[model samples]
Target: MAAGDIIPVHLYLCPLTLPGLSSDQQGRLLDTLPLDEQQKVMRYRMASAREKGLLVRCYLRALLSKAHTQLNQSSLNQSPLNQSQLNADIDGAIGPSEWRFDYLDKGKPVLSKAFFARSQLVFNLSHSGDYMLLAIAKSPRLELGVDIERLRQNTNIHAILNHYFTRQEREAMLALPSTRQRERFFDLWALKESYIKAKGLGLALSLKSFYFELSETECQALSFKGLDARQARLEQAARLFLVKEDSQQTDLGNDPQQAQPAAGWQSKLWQLDDEYRFALSLSSTDPLDLRCEMVSAQALLSE
Candidate 1:
């Protein structure tokens, strides 16, 4: 696929936890980046890997299969490949079935502005301690970001608030009852994290600058800072979903008819069944009932 082509992700939850993952690029993506960038990527990667690494890998492989169908088999046959660089090279070709860019540093020696700016395609990989969330969308659909945290320990919600929450957000968070507020607080945090991740511009964009309509009930996007965050709005493209694997919510394996191909994620909020708190953003497209396809990370793997 050309860099400008439409490449949307279909998210998934890996069944493996962070500690459960142990192979290749299955659990550790941060190591590929520069040391400085590692911390930021580590900020999120460690969470997913620590919590949902295994499941994330399973789900990601499933998502890749979906993209694989769209690939021209003949073209794939003609491309030169090396088994050792299989994953990296194929990633260079088809991009991600589910990939992301937010924490990518522009000044880093390993990553370039052009690399993260592959404007047409974007996907997200997130995990806490037990569940990994994978989301895919067109660059035009929704600029999306996501963070998964294990529901462990004290969660230290209060301390983190001082670092990222704006005055208004902090007030809004505190105004609610403690129990309910904690849950809502996380949703809002995930929403903001997801927003930043999708922006791909990283910390240069202030967390408080863009105000997200994050409620337990809905997902909304608004730029409060009037910063350049506006361009991050992915226009026209839709966020569609297909199930390559099953989770807690729906069961597609029972219905063969459900496995039909989809036009795109036009407008629909379908659940894939992993319950570690998953949400999606669509740019704006019509909804269509399509079958979920599977793309192999191995498909991207060079022969």
Candidate 2:
């Protein structure tokens, strides 16, 4: 990626196969939802969100069901409180983080607000085409955002960029060599969007305020708008990062400031399993020491 680029830090792929859950398995799961979550499900019952939410909840319950069996020969047909206690030791270690499902959480996740209503693990999730975009915080309790979109070859680049992007950004694309169509456009589009999501201020930031410049190895971001320039005071990205020979600027997730001009945000793009193109983003004061792991919903299931 060119400077001010949003590079993907890691990629995790899980199998789709899941063992069917029995009635006892399903019941044990819903019984763990907090009062508010239960009420929210009740309010949105029968909706797609409700269905997806329940599916994820059941996935968690299944994991716990297995765990319960291992810890003791306890049947999962117990009261909710008992199940919670029996699974306490496992929950403490595995916890909500293991489940990592945000298929129905609000905007960007706030640890406390989304998972269990007030925890602070800070992550965001979105899925497009056949992939999911997961933006996670390494630490420092920062706000994070990420997106993964498929390359629709026939997309009208001029139109979409004209509408969502500032004039200069569009010009950069037009001025590019005819050979750099799909890759360049997607890189710029992702960087612009990922930056907006990171700010958490939504569309309030204008595309013209910043520009992502492309270089041989990476992209760099520069702030044209005073608002974005001032954002540096908060250590937010006003530019992007491409890659280089040195490793001093490795983990942008924890130390985003390492990204400099002539190379925009530091992000990684990977072709995974021949099914999708993936980009993961992280913003931190320093490059994050991310412990990347690939786990299935089954791995997180309770005994």
Candidate 3:
């Protein structure tokens, strides 16, 4: 992959609580979804989760509508509805018929053959605490995966890291002089989780298969002695390793199939707020030009 070939990614973040939307207004947003999605929203056992689900779908529909309209402009032009009418029906522009989903063997979601074949877009959704994140990659599906976690104090960082992290990693973490060991632990966890999510295998893959070395200004993935070097080579060739303070080569493992082969894969981390850390993995070797936007309450709850 060309180092200068930048891949543009759109990331939308919506706070769980909207500024002016009421319970009734939120219900109306849920109504805009097709029955299946509505059922999914209603099935949530907790009110907070249910509201977050509803808002996510609303944001998703808005994103989908914008993307689909841009892709099929000719069809929109041929429609009887005028521009004003089309704008007014934004929620219904790409209706239920145009959307489709399938699942990976391990249950990670994927776009159906027909839908992706037409739009070539891939998206991943993640929510934690008070925020919901939706990521979209344009044509030539990026096979993206995103994750966010609120930094909480209850996690047993040392114990969990000792159990799951590689010896080298454990040593590194232990060696850190900073008192923020817990924060560092979550940073590693977020990156690892996002990497696996991007692979679409979730936690089914062994944590020992890969380990990361993270610092304030550098991040790198290192392979074990017996690890599959071929996978490492593929990651290097794709240039999908973590960011560093300077340009340097990174190693991968033997399994190319772990990530989207054609598109390769890349991972990123961002501290979105004081209490949350966000991680993103994308199936692209090109440098990521991630565009993060905060969706307004009015835009999401509007017709």
Candidate 4:
């Protein structure tokens, strides 16, 4: 495949607290959203929950608008049409507030067909604790999902594993030392959620139908500071597997080789902070090049 055919995924992490927007700015930002989105934001019972919802939607619109502009500019450069026509096309481009959305039967939102034709962008949104994560890829062929979880000491890890996880997955976590079990639980949960979200099946797909085999791999040293620097120590490479009950030979620790890899899917896990675990899944057979950056509330809103 040519270089242009390969999909590139972009991750934007926005913290809800840093450089918080004022009341007036917040109202104006809310006003920019579509009616349904504004109502959705209002439905959040708690102030914090409402703020997170607002930021995620607004940032999504800003990013989509930017993507649309870049796509248009790229096409304009290649078109034989004169500058006058190009200028007219640029003026006709849709704004963030004007964008439309459609949702899958399972509640995963996607760009409406009208706007999708102009830019074949696919995106997924997730939030946990004080941060919201947005994953975007610019190809109709690509599907993307991202999830973040803040590690907490009060979670009932064993009960959850027993109910939702595959036998192999449960055994792997149980075998771990008690001190590490919580972290391991969140790791698996984030990965599984990302996979389901990527598939757009939500909880309609049984969690036991699939499992992930996570193993440590050496990652490249990060030259940049801040989040990337912390990621150097926390990121672990993982592979996805499907449960084949009839075969009955899948073992968590002893015989990983017997498991079947889930083809055309790729996932990565990262420790964004001391308290948060993040994972991303993409439907692509090609090598993945995922770029991540932390964007502040001010920066995202200003864009």
lDDT score for candidate 4 against the true structure: 0.77
RMSD of 3: 11.0
Expressed as tens digits, the lDDT of each residue in 3-55 for candidate 3 is: 55666576777677645457788777877887898899999998867777777
Better candidate by TM-score, 2 or 3: 3
Off by over 4 Å in 3: 1-4, 19-23, 68-98, 218-264
TM-score of 3: 0.72
Check candidate 3 and list the clashing pairs.
228-254, 231-253, 231-254, 232-252, 232-253
Q: Output the lDDT of residue 200, model 3.
A: 86
Instruction: Report the lDDT of model 4 for residue 284.
Output: 78
Distance from true location, Cα of 83 in model 4, Å: 5.0
**In model 4, where do residues sit more than 4 Å from their true spots?**
1-5, 18-20, 71-93, 221-234, 245-259, 300-303
RMSD of each: 15.8, 14.1, 11.0, 3.6
| Clash count for each candidate, listed in order shown | 32, 60, 5, 0
Q: Candidate 1, which segments miss by more than 4 Å at Cα?
A: 1-9, 18-62, 70-120, 138-142, 214-275, 281-303
User: Which window of ten consecutive residues has the lowest lDDT sum in model 1?
Assistant: 224-233
- The C-alpha lDDT values of all candidates are 0.43, 0.44, 0.63, 0.77
lDDT of 2 by residue, 40-147 (tens): 655665554443454444433343333323323222233345656757634543343233334322254344334433222345544555333444432333545555
